[model samples]
Target: MRPAPVVLVSGTETVLADRAIRLLRDTLRAEDPTLEVSDLEAGSYAPGELLTLASPSLFAEPRMIRVDGVEKTSDAFLEEALAYLRSPADDTYLVLRHAGGVRGKKLLDAIRGGLGGGVEIVCAELKRDADKLDFVSAEFAAARRRITGGAQRALVAAFSDDLAELAAACQQLLADTDAEITEATVEKYYGGRVETTAFAVADTAIAGRHGEALGLLRHALASGADPVPMVAAFASKVRTMAKVAGARGGGNQIAAQLGLAPWQVDRARRDLQGWTDEGIGRVIEALADTDAQIKGAGRDPVYALERLVGIVASRGEDQHSPQRTG
Candidate 1:
């Protein structure tokens, strides 16, 4: 298929958006070795700069112009871009990256709807376990390899907090091993790392396993996991549960409304089995105190997190007792 003259990459997922841009550059370079690639930040460029870069060269060589942060672009740049789009140079490929905002909707709509052979590539953020699983599977498939479901879950659990790290892990595994990726493979490569991420701590705490949660929290801190993200994870989980509990629709509908994957909604529903509104409120209050303590409102962040784990695990058990204040 012929490449589009103008490409609009829209999304907040930095990793995916970056991958798309790289793939486009690679494709153009392969087709023409003399392709000239230029990178620009829309928020910092001078007026008429885009037109000058996209203008056909004296030798008429193939060129690819990549402009990032277009959502914060200047009006002058937008006007110049829109004018150039009307009569795009045949040897030029323009790539615009926007991180999902309404700041430049006029230019965005013009590019998306104009007759310049434009293509819109979505790089929506992946917030659900299922979406991350599909990403892992796709990575393996791209390399003509296979990964077991257990292995996929393990990888996601290990690096759930960072998509870029997860992608790097997939690539590293592919490079380091020739066998099909499996749960055993993940354990062999990232066992200690898995125990230290916030998700692991949050998982056990939300399951009401106080002992396991405390142990995991200790291991996580000892292994260099920051206290801030750990508490943030707790906040994230509780917020998701609250959203799911208060939602009025089915899994898919609620997932869409919450920008979550359907499985996440279902998982949150299951996790809310014994949780009461009063219990959730108490846990949220405890988390707030821990958040403050870790950020200097109190002393001993570690103690704060431990107390938080105890409070969260004990949620829905005794509503009358006062929550521990760090």
Candidate 2:
């Protein structure tokens, strides 16, 4: 619909509204003055405020009423909004934004149920991995940048999973390289995911420090950290534990595979001296789960990592903890 009176755009971040508004504006004649964009989220307006602006002089342009901060408004305020949406003014556009959540779900549903056709622009968050990929493709298309699947995943892996951060990284990389967007270019310019970030994230997770791990994961992901590399790094350490255990009792194939000097392998055996096979097994399993999560098998990468650390670190004692079987 060129002018949808009721638009229900919901998401964690209000990143899409700007473009949605622009797309709606472009539908109008260029010289209209009444084109309005409202930030009604401050609070839904009283019915009286819904009054359309007086018609401009014949030469003046059209008008638009944009309401923002709709979620911030009270229930009564939202209820009053229905009156305006009931009969939206012609020659004007209205846009409403909700940051998304139950705080105002009813009002949103009502808007959609009612004046949905009048909705002009709707852009919600792209939270899922597939949505993120779609965003990357769209961004590349907009830039006329040729990007392949490898290039897309590379961008996703280099940028934090957050859509805005990912989008910003794409923009920055696109600008800096001024070349076709490809995997190699993304890797070359966007691979600096910060020093020891993966290590810190993994360590805190494995230490059973949920709060610390969460903060670290959020910080890292927000800063455009690559989940795949982080998972790989963490997996590498778990494999190390596995190696140490395997080599603990004359089973040195893993040590040899890792290219450890005899002395180094000996040190590893010493470090793993008291760890039982089950202890190491649990840790490896947890690591596998972490890997799966990073690869999109599980939910909430941050939470998954947190649970992994807890399961691994806590299981060391359970290896000896008495069984509860009756």
Cα lDDT listed for each candidate? 0.82, 0.59
Candidate 2, residues 177-277, lDDT tens digits: the string is: 76677777766765555535676666555454545765776788788876777767667655665666654222223446777533334334433545577
Off by over 4 Å in 2: 26-41, 44-47, 52-60, 103-106, 120-124, 195-326
**Candidate 1 overall Cα lDDT vs. reference?**
0.82
Over 1-326, each residue of candidate 1 has an lDDT whose tens digit, in order, gives 23688999998777787789889998999999999998776766688777788777989999899887688787877878888778898889899888778978887899778657788999888999999999999999999998999999999888875677689899999999999899989989887673337877887888888888888888889978889989988898899999998987544467789998654675677679888999899888888888999999987788788888888888744322234563
How high is the lDDT of residue 87 in model 1?
Answer: 88
Each prediction's RMSD to truth: 11.6, 18.1
lDDT of 2 at 298: 73
